[model samples]
Target chain A: MPTRARRWHISWLLLAAATIPLLAVVSLFVGVSEVSLAALLSGQDGGRAAEVLMISRLPRTLALILAGSGMAVCGTIMQMLARNRFVEPSTAGTVESASLGILAVMLLAPGLPMFGKMLVAALFALAGTSLFLAILRRIPLRSVLLVPLVGIMLGGVISAITTFFAYRTDMLQSISAWTTGDFSGVLRGRYELLWIAAGLTLLAYFAAARFTVAGMGEAFATNVGLNYRRIVALGLLIVSMVTAAVVVTVGMVPFIGLIVPNVVSLALGDNLSKSLPWVAILGAGFVLVCDIAGRLILYPYEVPIGTVIGIVGSAFFLFLILRPNARVA
Target chain B: MIELKSVSKQYGDTLVVDGVDLTLPKGGVTSIIGPNGAGKSTLLSMMSRLLPMSTGWIGIDGLDVTKTRGDVLARRLSILRQDNHMTARLTVRDLVAFGRYPYTKDRPTGEDKVHVDRALGFLDLQPLADRFLDELSGGQRQRAFVAMVLCQDTDYALFDEPLNNLDMRHAAGMMRLLRRAADHFNKTIVLVLHDINFASCYSDHIVAMKAGKVAFQGAPDAVMQASVLTEIFNTDMAIHEIAGRKIAVFY
Candidate 1:
């Protein structure tokens, strides 16, 4: 390794840290309701400014941070376990499975609480991930590019099933809206499930080295005395739960997981322990900036964070596909 | 001693390794040589517990490999496979340091660092230790991986085709290093080698296999006969004595 790349740099981290609050502050001020600290302090705008900031702006900002960081971290774990960089919750049918779970709960119980629905979604997500992995292991992959294509196809199959079910149940509008991933509907008490995702992201950091070892492949990891199967199961569980929480709360952001980790790896290399904090920070920052852009693009109105992220993230994904010597596992 | 009792590997109906029973004594170099599809690598993998056996038991130092705890077995034995492709961009030193993982589990002690450095030095990888594995040539990467298994510092170290992709000078140098590893440290080294000449030169005992069965095994002097070499490989070989070592010329 180059001497510069060997040690983790404090300056880069400081810059990432500096960017989050800057973006968060910017996001806080650009909402549809023109609310400000000055207005709140003066007890003006009939006190509506404080409620809007507290209920809408603050919660939306926090949701963006949680969902962004959560999805990025989930992506990292999924990629490691799947042993393919392009595999993420959305691509691998995890998001679609969670949506299917939500749809099932809506039709079956019709009385399940939000937490109950999230639990069902998580279980379904886990199963979906396992199915994708089983399919992945069956085929001999000649190119790194084929792995994600398989995942996208798997996701497409599950998505078609979910869409068909939604249409039959007359819940297509509701399900379609949920899958689009907008922070516009985020308000007090609605985004709390995302806190579970935040907690899971911390657990991922604690197990970062194990996940890194698992990425080397089952045989190599077992030789090192790690239980390859157990670690993989843990990783999949983490990815599924995080996906379920984020999907349920803020909906699906297409490629935060894919783009953030690749960018971090290119800059810092792929040592998960060293690169994890950066992944988290950059994930949060990327979403915050994108969310800010969405809020401002039509000013006084808003573009869904998912729509903006989808547009920008796909562009970045295209660049990754077209880049020279694109070595992805 | 590593003991295998009726160990076999079956993929569906094909028996890759069938009823292999052998006890490899402790210390010195033992080479398993055979033609293609001879199950040499498969048997090595089974012994190292990298591949599960279908119908038998393997005991390393009296501890059943299938029953022993992973970390405990790790401390007792280690293995290096032919293909070490990985997605993580690890430096040679970082890769070697993983040998200490069984002991340190990600937290490297001063002693672990010492072992890592010593292994790196042993393989002449000190200069390339800081380089990323992908940046190095095949021979260099092979040496780096050897350094890692050496760093594991286990009593029993297994390598599958350790000399693949190496040129002549590096191949001989690698065999010499492995020979020293066995002789100087009294470590039990098991290797699967395709090059019979290298095995003949360095191995104290050679086991030849064909069609998933051990065809012949003995001290190099006994097993390297022209008739035995010709029978196992199905090619006529002329054995010549050079510097008191048997060299087979089959090409």
Candidate 2:
């Protein structure tokens, strides 16, 4: 046999490539009603089982892939922008700001279009990120470890403002549905908007290296002729916009960004130009696997993908923090 | 040519860099040497736009360094500071590849690869190109970072304490590299150096800074005199000519 055809970083690629399909297949088949390969291939909407598969499984699978991959890449981009591996759209306040924007639109103009809500959310998210970044520049902390803590606090303040308004309006339950971001609710037309996250992922891939270079401090990047601020602005725009789109379409799924990118960087190293494609793949795969497990782990009444991922993802992040070599970047 | 007009920087009540006007000729190496707390680094930082000036202006090659698009100014100028800690984990090779980002927009072509290779080789980092930065020795990483800056291939390169952590052999090697870069490439090299001997021996022009101002600006022969050295450093110093080079000893 040919010596196991090995390429540098190929094993991760192969593992990721192989897992994508298996998880995708399992995602389609392992939902509330167990639709086997035969049943899916038969193409008949027979009984309540077929409706469950058609309405639930198919859209859930697409949503899992989209939300998972979208959050992951968004996290990756935010981490690069803030130069801290711990930060993502969720932690950096983009998601919360977006949610607030959506809520405000929902309350202020109860019949606003989804795209309009997302646009408003995207603008607020971008503004929030810029606000946090601006405040961050004020504090002279050379250690980037402290920066994320500040962002989290900044996000907390914004979230408190959001929660206060959410309570006053008594739309908590309505907003909470969009907040938890489970794929179980995603179906045909409802979830199609998440494709925007997919498009934003492509934009991120195109700008990956520029973002990474900008990560290496302003002077160094500017010295190389990169418009450090402009590249950073574009990067932040992509991150906030993608984040807003994800939150608007699906809801808040935390740490997919933070965990996936860091893991890819650790395994793949920091050539983001090379790491981005893999980040996207692994991001989508990790989320899909988690969502599928969430569906199958409890059977009939599926556990929320975000909850399952939050529990597991936080553990990975904790491990990252405790890891001796972990520098938070 | 580089020019600074009435440049000043203040942090609260303390002025780090006082109002200063100066002109620097193009080409060759120029060293900015000053006593501790004299704002040599701050002055250099202001010149390169690394630290924005509080009041005044800087122009490089006829374009305002402050007003020009960062990438446009970047193609013409570059600066490397003392500390080069990075959040991104990168191999020596990957780190050098980033130097082309301003021009190539992160999509490095074959020509970019050649430039990366040349920078690595120039810094004697060919063997360690594949090695991770964290895996390398401190001095080695310092050299790797320097190689990344040099790989930028800009005409004007500014370095703040390039020899900070280098061993004797590497320190000599770095000075030689900077000189070769200036001479061979027709590049303008600006550096903030602590070692007066290195500046005296290797620099074409010298800017001795004191109390946030340019105390003196002249050729090494003029600036390295016993009186100038004593006045600049505020210590008694003796100057000796060895092999037609000025070497100052202060005890």
Candidate 3:
């Protein structure tokens, strides 16, 4: 029995695959350093350029790929699970919940290791996402516009709580900086948790078809013998853990998840198993482009990637909202 | 046989499906017909395990529906609800392929492909198999969904309002296909149909419900009588025999 041919479009796959390394190479060169290729190849200038490249530039680039692709995958999974195109960690309260968890851990266990902090954040994220889904189940959800609005409001409530606590504890500055989503602080050891997020993205790839069926709604999924609730739980777990990893490691990069998946689906259709690779590649490529833009925009003074994405992402999001045909599928 | 023992469903104080016992024959076209709010769809939902019975138990071929593993039951029975609005953009072929998920679990074997192709052909959907579902007309979309259910290849198949958006031509075609499925494959086909004429013409047995209880059940000829139809529907219904078939006229 020959299996149905996988719907992998070799042209798009190759193009996206090729774009990532090109962006990575360009990203490796964009920074405060003035190290030419000839200088590095000569081995003449005492390895200062090599040290800076290895320590800061390489780690930063890796962090961008991991966090970007991870968040995009998180967005894709959340969107599918919610049956709304606008869902992502930032909108869905997962990021705020992670921030709240980080703040709590800072106050309660100030000396907790990074891994422990990520675990706490991930747990809180899972709880927050569950609450969101519970709220979603109660509503009629007839309008497509209402879904993201509800999510944004939920996020606002959680963010307000986090801000209140930060204010009372006199740690608003630290908390705000942590949540700003800058890649400048992504050192070798600090960005390792995003690796776990990368692994979760792979798990999402393996479970893509189940998630697609689950996205068709509970009855459709259950009738086909897929465990709808279990699949939804798995999706939420992946979404929360990935969001937590990105939030802890590099802060919240808002719209990468929402936009990348939307763009990929627009071009390639919604067969998740076939489209996930493109989603990952485009996600990484998009972040690299944005990070480089932020770095070069201010030259010696680096602008945060979060601020850059926030501006561009919000504009694109508004376009989606106001677009004449953005009706719910 | 699909057997229900004192099955009932309630929402708070309102009992949508009253405690009723029923035993459906193993293989035939059985159409459940009722007016608005007759609990016909609700009863079908419970029998197929799509909705939990407030009390009592349902057994399909001696296996308790509530206790059977979902995959096992999926191979035995499949049900489709009225509304199937999907956010994902899926082609008809992709949608039908999902019917085999119970057996293949995402990895489609050549056998699964055969089932999908056969189901598509059964519904005459081969020409539009690659077209996106949203792009199809309402009647075409209904056929696509029926194709998916048929591709599930279960022993018993149930549908709620399968003719809701279909035109007369498509509706009649759908009924003929369902009748053929029962006759050729020896499958138990159950449907909640609003059109009494369609039921009278295509169904081997008819079950009529009123106010949450079964009012009549028998061969189509017996239930299609003017007295039974008028009483169950609370209106004037005239039954005429033509070419040895009972036709109901309620206009």
Candidate 4:
């Protein structure tokens, strides 16, 4: 029986690993410009196909992989730290806080480099996530449903503040552009910051066991000689930094964090060390598919990946919440 | 030896474990019997460094629990509370393997795997090793947790009501296992038990607590008398000798 289970695990992992690059290749061809593999291979069109592939398609595909995997890993870490299955950066005010930070930089230091903007946004995300956790601690009745509800409320308030300021400064259009996740603007130079998110995701994988132990609760972690508070702090730092990088580079991609981790956990169980790779792979693949579908749905005109994910993710979220037998934490 | 000097835990204005000064010798089973609010669990928590003391000291073999590093203390001592709720869905083997974290962090050595398997076999949990925790019965889960603590290989182990959800057969089996751990492995075992008969049958020493203080402490034979048991529990009780053991009978 155990051997069978192990075999099943490996086969699924292999399938997921093979699916990601296939999706990436498919995503590369789905853009408005006709950059076919044959053309690129033949070097036909005086390097125009190569140029588009390098300047746009490759970067967008890489960005999708990095951001998707990063956001999904961030969701898993957030869920562990919060001890709630439903909490994610998008719902927990982390993305809104990043938006607020971007707005602040735009108003206060308009000439700051992208790296500087990402750092400030990361700090703001850390603070905002900590604030959400603080609020969670204060409320004694921490039902599974109540946690995400609180986060959504906090995100609503922060976004409201950002909107009011943007309206006054006439930066509302730019703010909207930055707040809605669209990969069409992802050029070679614009999307490299997501590599930091990808790096943080790798760091998360190394610390996966500690995060799993921490998710068992404070007493349990202490019993095993783990520094519970330190692990939680580290987890939040990773989550916030990743959120900041993604939001700053590609705007807010809602529910990839929520939907991907939940689906992964449902399939693979919540053992972080065993399940994290699957989470990353599935997350990248899910986003890649969404991006491809978005590009092809309108054929030359595109729906943002954010809109595609939001519509699909919210339905899955509703199913999770409304399911009678959800083994919620 | 585990030594406690004036250990107290206070929450706001209420004192839970008040000025507890005691010493538990090594290499035997000691049962702490008390009512719900008598602070037995709180004192145990303070001793194990799970709950910080308001004003006091706890030393396991002369190493102060507060001053020593957590991993260092963890190697010497381990504690398990009654309500062990976990967000992560771990198999029994995975959970047991975590007992070696203090030594290996996350990468389990071959020796650690041996210890895990030994602990699983000790607890009769080998068959259930691959099952997720939520899939097990309460008694089976309780045994899995005990296996983890045993796999930790600490010198001193404390359990806060280890028999909470066990059926009679498993409860007795658990006591026997703890007794064997004490006798065979030379571990210092401390437990908070509501069942006085089990304490009398299995424990070498019994400490009875009342109103956040130790009312009495001695051998089980000395502490299991009708008058002492009656006063500690605030109930009418009688002691009967069954198979050369003192059994408290209260209706």
Task: Give i-RMS (Å) per prediction.
Answer: 1.6, 1.9, 1.3, 1.4
Give lDDT tens digits, candidate 4, residues A73-93: 999999988888889998899
The alpha-carbon deviation from the true structure for residue B86 of candidate 4, after best TM-score superposition, in angstroms, is: 1.3
Can you write out model 3's per-residue Cα lDDT over A1-329, one digit (the tens) per residue? 11344434666588778988889888888888776677678867888778778888888999999999999988889988998999889988899999999999989998999889999999999999889889999999889888888888999999999999999999899999888999998887889898999999999999999988887788888898888889999998999888888988899899998899988877666778778888899899999999999989989889899999999899989988888778844
Best by DockQ: 3
Q: Report the Cα lDDT for residue B118, model 3.
A: 96
For candidate 3, write residues B60-132 as lDDT tens digits: 9999988898888999899999888888877899889999988988788889888999999988899998787
Lowest-sum lDDT 10-residue window in model 1 chain A: A1-10
Candidate 4 error regions (>4 Å): A1-11, A327-329
| Segments in model 1 whose C-alpha atoms lie over 4 Å from true places | A1-8, A327-329
For model 2, the chain A TM-score is 0.91
TM-score of each: 0.97, 0.93, 0.97, 0.97
Candidate 2 iRMSD in angstroms: 1.9
Model 2 alpha-carbon miss at residue A250, Å: 2.4
Chain A TM-score of each candidate structure, as shown: 0.96, 0.91, 0.96, 0.97
The stretch of ten residues in a row with the least summed lDDT in candidate 2 chain B is B99-108
Q: Which pairs clash inside model 1?
A: A1-B130, A84-A329
The alpha-carbon lDDT assigned to residue A243 of candidate 2 equals 81
